[model samples]
Target: MTITIRSALMKNFLGDSPDWYKWVIISFLLLNPLVFFLVSPFVAGWLLVVQFIFTLAMALKCYPLQPGGLLAIEATLIGMTSPAHIGEEIANNLEVLLLLIFMVAGIYFMKQLLLFLFTKLLLSIRSKMLLSLAFCGAAAFLSAFLDALTVIAVVISVGTGFYAIYYNVVAKQADNNSQIADDSLIDNPEHQQIMEQFRSFLRSLLMHAGIGTALGGVMTMVGEPQNLIIAKNAGWGFVEFFLHMTPVTLPVFVCGLLVCLLVERFRLFDYGTKLPEPVREVLKEFDRKASAKRNRQDKVKLVIQALVGVWLVVALAFHLAEVGLIGLSVIILVTSFCGVTDEHDIGKAFQEALPFTALLTVFFTVVAIIIEQQLFSPVIQFVLQAPPSTQISLFYLFNGLLSSVSDNVFVGTVYINEARAALEQGLISLKQFEMLAVAINTGTNLPSVATPNGQAAFLFLLTSSLAPLLRISYGRMVWMALPYTLVLTLVGLLCVHYALVPVTEWLTQWNWISPPSLNVISSVTAH
Candidate 1:
């Protein structure tokens, strides 16, 4: 009886994850506190950070929340980071939290509109390369003005919808229609092959669209959460922010599009998988049936969602309110007019974002540990101490490398604050500060695409239901993003190294951008 009880308890831990994984997590929990006491807290803190990232990398084996949360709880108990500091981190990032909670849910209510539009586009575009470009270009454009998370949510919705359409068709053809959730139900080798092909097709498009968000996201203040943080520190308004980034961001953006084309054209890094014809036919039939069944009320709902999407774009463009509040407005407007009043129905919308929100909160605990430990301080000091001629490129390179492993928003916040502090002490010229600010923005946004954890959108997609369905593990995502990551990081580095100074001078010469004003700097620094 004792043995049975112990076995049951072990089985219950992490709920069907691999036994090795459960043991690894158990080991992590046991290791953190011992290291904290026997070793320096700083060393233990870095170890915890690596462990947290390990959990994230193994996200496909189990959700990061359970294992990562356990680590966080252990950290707090061991005095690596206090609950107070964790709360402070969460409080500081409340806006981003709200955006995830509400904006993603708001977009959930509009999935039908997204599916309708994307299905049409999918059906119309026969050329895989052209379709890839459309996905990349549209994602970039949307992410430029709207939130990357929201744009990625839309893409995920479309991917899920398309997958379901083909999945059901395949399941029915296999005479296992009731087992829709199980991929193993399709015993026929041909059906299984088509399914694999379909997954590859979706994977390519998703990679393109994901990279698109990064390409356009670095271009404007509203493109990323960190971009706004950098802009505020530098006293840049929306237009000024856009102009400031144009030197590096514009060239990087063009190069990014070109990379997309070259990869798709050459079929590099799993990019050229064409949508299987049978799956396309299934999607077409599903769309036809869906269209035929659509009533006037359904049409009205689509129209309402379209209008709300417009509002989402405009509100975000104008900085109408905190993004979360705007997202809440979208939720109220979308659900109320769309006739989705049931409590259960509305609750389904929260399913996608809530888990991610919880994971993000847990992520803040790790960030708190970093803060309490000052793990990044030495690197910041090294960069700051470098000569002015070498400082810009170092800042860009270090920021990119750090952001690839850590949260870009946190990395940007820390570096930008240090830069602002230097300026306040009159250590660097205002012009040099401006250059550093742009480098920080581009650095954080561009190369962080190397890992799922580097960008919130990538992390969100990694944890979404869609990733598992598409077989997009962390390693697969990294592999697929390699070309874009290399191109974006290398191009961004060169532009920062060579083009930024001359381009900024020209922009200033033509009055396209203003030199940093001492008065503005002083006033901002005063607060």
Candidate 2:
């Protein structure tokens, strides 16, 4: 009986995950303490980060929250980081937490409208290249004002909806023909190939859209969370912030669009997969049925959601309230008038965002460990100690490297604070400070697209329901994003190194930027 119970418990652990994966997680649990005790806490902290990333990389096998949370709990219990520090990290990023919780849920409620619009887009745009460009361009434009996560959530919903519509059609046909007994149709080779082609097509568009978020996400103060932090420290308003980033962002944005075209033109990196005709027919039929079945009430709901979307854009652009609060207001308005008062119905909206939100909290725990261990301090110190002439480029490059491996927001926050401290000590002039602030903002935003771990949008997409169905994994995402990452990072770095100083000089002469010496500011402005 004892042996049977032990077997049951082992079987219950990480249910359905491969036995090897289960053992790997178990080994990670056992190894952390030994490394923490016998080795330096710093090494142990870095090890924990890598272990958490391993969980993320194997996300298709099991959710990262369970395994990553286990590591986080162990790290805290072993005194690598305290609960208080974790709480502090969460507190520092409370706005982002709220955005994930409320904003993404709010987006969930708008899926009907999103699906309707995107279906039309898919059918109308016959060219795969144009369709890809549209997805990328639209995401970029939306992300410039709305949160990147929110924009991606919308895309994920639309993509999943698109996938579901066609998948049901295929499954039903397969069932009628009795060619495949399974629901997935994996046994039917022809349908399997068609599905694979469709998945590839969707995957490419999703990747382009993901990169698009990064492209536009660097343009404004509200683009990314860290953009606001850097803007506040540099004392730049919206127009000034936009102006400051234009030197780097504009060039990168143009190059990014061109890269989008080139990749599709050459069918590089698994892009340019034309939408399979069967899948297109399925989507077209679904769109036709949807449009035909639309009643006045349904039309009103779409209109309401559309108006709310407009309100969302305007609200975020004007900084009317904290992002999450605006998102809450959206939830209230949409649910109140759209005839969705049922508890279960509203609760369904939370399903998509809550898991990722929990994972984000786990991410903060890892960030807390980084803080306690000062793992990034040496990099911070190195950049700060670099010569002034080269400091901007160094800050840009190092922030990019660190952000690619860690959370970009955390990396940006730390570097900006350090740069502000330098400003206070008169080590760097306000002119140089403004330049560094730009570097940090662009650095964290542009280059961090290299991996899912680097950008929250990419991470969200990787862990999202759409990822597994589309066969998008961590390595796959890195592979797809390679071209955009290269173009954005290289263009951004060159512009920062060569174009930034000249642009700043021109802005200063135009009185758009005040000369640091003429303005005797006491210290960097705190957010």
Candidate 3:
């Protein structure tokens, strides 16, 4: 009886995951406190950061939130980071939290409209290359104005819908043939190969679209949450922020589109998988049936969602309200007008966003630990000690390197605060400060696409319900994003070193950027 009870307890603790994973997590938890005492709190904190990333990398095997949150709780208890510090991190990023919670859910409610529009594009565009370009361009445009994660959510939904339609048709066909085994349909060699090809096709387009987000996301103040933070610290409004980023962002944007075209045309980096003809037929037939069944009311709902989507874009572009608030308004307007009135239906909308929101909060705890440990201080200090002539480019390179591994928002927040301190102390001129601000924004946004770990949107897409079905793993994402990463980072570096510096100097010489007056300095110092 005693042995049976122990076995049941172990089983309960392990749940559905493998026992080895449970032991691995337990080891991570056990090893941290020992490291904290044996080495140093700083060393232990760094170890914890590494362990948290390990959990994220193994996300397909187990949800990272459980183990990551456990690590966070252990860190607090062991004095690596205080509960108060974690709370402070959360408070500092409340806008981001609200955006994830409400904006994602808002996009969920708009799926009918999104699906309708994407379905039309998929059906009308016969050329695979053109369709890929359309996806990339549309994703870039939307991400420029809306949140990247929200835009990716729409893309994922469309991909998932198409896969479901194809699979359902395949399943029905298998049922009609006795030679095909329903249980082995996914595992059959020929069928699996075709599915793999289809997945590769989806993976390529999704990567293009994901990279598109990064391209447009660096263009404006509202393109990313970190951009807003940097902009606010610099005392720049919407227009000023746009003008500041334009020097680097615009050229990078053009180069990014060209890279998209080149990659598809040359079929490089695991791209160029054409859609299987049978699957294409399945999707086309599905669209036809869906269209034939649509009535006047269905058309009206699509129209209503379109109007609400337009409103969302306009509101975000004008900085009408906090993004989260605008997203909340979108939810109310779309649901009420489009007849999504049932409480259960609304509850379903929250399903996709809430888990990610919780994971984001857990991420803040890890960031809190980084703060308590001062892990990034040495790097920031070293960069600040560089000559003023090279500081902007160094800032860009440092930010890109760090943001590729850590959270960009946290990195941006820390660097901007440090830069602002330098400005207040008269260590850098206002022109230099503005240039560093641009570097911070573009740095954090652009190079972070090298891995999903760098960007919240990429990570969200990697861990979404769609990823497993599409066979997109962490390593796979890195490989797929490689070409884009090389192009964007190189182009961004060149623009910063050569183009941005010269343009800013020209603007300053022409009085386009006024010297820092006392009032301006005071305002910056006060903030």
Per-residue lDDT tens digits for candidate 2, residues 1-527, read 45687778779999989999999999999999999999889999889978886777676688888998999999999999999988976776677678767877887788778767766777899898899889888888878866788778878878887777777676765314223224456557888899889889999989998999999889987678788667656766566788889999999999999999899999999898999998888888777887899999999999999999999887876678877888899899999989999999999978867887798788788877876787766765677688876889999998898788767876787678677766776778778888899999999999999988778899889978788888898889999999988989999999999999898889878988667544325334322
Candidate 1, poorest ten consecutive residues by summed lDDT:
172-181
Q: Write the per-residue lDDT of candidate 1 for residues 361-448, one digit (tens) a residue.
A: 8877887787789876677678778887578999998889978986786677667766876777677888888999988999899999
RMSD of candidate 2 to the true fold? 4.2
Off by over 4 Å in 3: 1-21, 34-39, 170-183, 186-197, 276-278, 417-430, 505-527
What are the runs in model 2 whose C-alpha is more than 4 Å off?
1-62, 78-82, 163-199, 221-241, 276-282, 405-410, 413-434, 459-475, 504-527
> RMSD per prediction, one decimal?
3.6, 4.2, 3.9
Name the TM-score of candidate 3. Answer: 0.86
Task: Please report how far candidate 3 places residue 194 from its true position, in Å.
Answer: 5.7
Taking the tens digit of each residue's C-alpha lDDT, what string does model 3 give over 1-527? 45687688768764777888888999998999999999899889889878887776566667777888899999999998888988977886687778777877888888788777777877788777888888888888878777787788888878877776666565555324332223355555766777778888888878888988888888776677788678767766565677778889988888888888888889988888888888888888877887899999999998998999999888876778887888899999999999889999988878877876787788788877886788766766787788875788999998998788866765677678678767877777877888899999999999999998788778879978888778888889999888889988999999988899778667657866554452246548555
Best by TM-score: 3
What are the runs in model 1 whose C-alpha is more than 4 Å off? Answer: 1-39, 77-84, 167-196, 235-238, 276-279, 405-410, 417-431, 453-475, 505-527
TM-score of each: 0.85, 0.83, 0.86
Instruction: Rank all candidate structures by their lDDT, best first, as comma-separated numbers.
Output: 1, 2, 3
> Candidate 2: lDDT over CA atoms?
0.82
TM-score, prediction 1: 0.85
lDDT of 2 at 430: 77
Clash totals in order: 0, 0, 0
| TM-score of decoy 2 | 0.83
Q: Which residue pairs overlap in candidate 2's backbone?
A: none
